[model samples]
Target: MKKYFLKLYQYNAWSNKRVLGTLQRQNVNDPKILSLMGHVVAAQFLWLHRIKGLPPPDVKLWGEYSLDQLLKLSEKAGKEWLEFVESNDNFDRQLTYTNYVGEPYTNNVEMIMVHLVNHSSYHRAQVAMLLRQKGFEPINTDFITYDRVITGQLKE
Candidate 1:
């Protein structure tokens, strides 16, 4: 189970860097794009803090960050998540955390890990659509693409 989640985190980090690189290469500093990416990075921190029994950071979920800021934050969050997954072995451990709306919920570590990746993927799709509408091609961040590239089946 730990191995599986580590692979997922690896994919997540790779895909995030791809998206960030695409945005940089396309010279896309769109507010919406930055905001979505910021939210993704912020949510990763939030969930990690919850899992680690730490307080949440002072960050706005929908905040619009500069492209450079997003790049740094995304990279930091990815590293932290990867390290957390590597150090932990109990994915089935349940955690209780409060939601943004002040609601309480309990979920196991596995579910939260899955949710973080899925949440990023969902927003990345939105970022891709926005880029396409603006006459730019988005980089492929699909899991299979990541797998292939890592395995040397496709050149990155």
Candidate 2:
């Protein structure tokens, strides 16, 4: 499980760098793209906080981050997550938390970790679609595609 989380984190960092490079080259300053990225960051931060029993951040604050700032924030978050997984010894994966809507939710540690990755992937895909609509092709966010390109893996 730890290994899987690490792979997901690596994929996220690589994909983030790719998207940042694309946005820089295209000079994509679309407000919607920025907004979507902000949501992605907010979602990650919110879950991390939940996992750590920390208070949630103000979602509105994410708007203060420009694309470049968001990229840096994402990198920071990635590093923080890696350090967290490295340092934690408790392997008990079960924890429960309520959602923003006051709904009951139960998730083990592994499930929470997977949720973090999947949640970001989903929002990033939306951002990519938005970028394409605005005439910019964002980097592919597919996990297998990422592994194949980054590791030069041949299809079986």
Give the candidate number with the greatest lDDT: 1
- Indicate the residue-level lDDT of 15 in model 1: 89
lDDT of 1 by residue, 1-156 (tens): 999999999999998999999999999999998899999989999999888989888777988799999899999999999999899888898899898888999998889999999999999999999999989899999999999999999998
What are the TM-scores, per candidate, against the unseen true structure? 0.98, 0.83
Question: What's the C-alpha lDDT at position 148 in model 1?
Answer: 95
- How far off is residue 99 in model 2, in Å? 2.6
Query: All candidates' lDDT scores?
Result: 0.92, 0.75
Clashing pairs in 2: 93-109
Give the per-residue lDDT of model 2 (tens digit) for 27-143: 888887777777777777777778888876665534756877878877877787777777776646777888777787878877778877887788788888888787788777688
Judge candidate 2 against the unseen true structure and give its global Cα lDDT, from 0 to 1.
0.75
Estimate the Cα RMSD of every predicted model relative to the unseen true structure: 0.7, 3.1
Off by over 4 Å in 2: 58-64, 89-92, 101-104, 152-156
Worst 10 residues of 1 by lDDT: 55-64
Alpha-carbon deviation at 68 in model 1, angstroms: 0.3
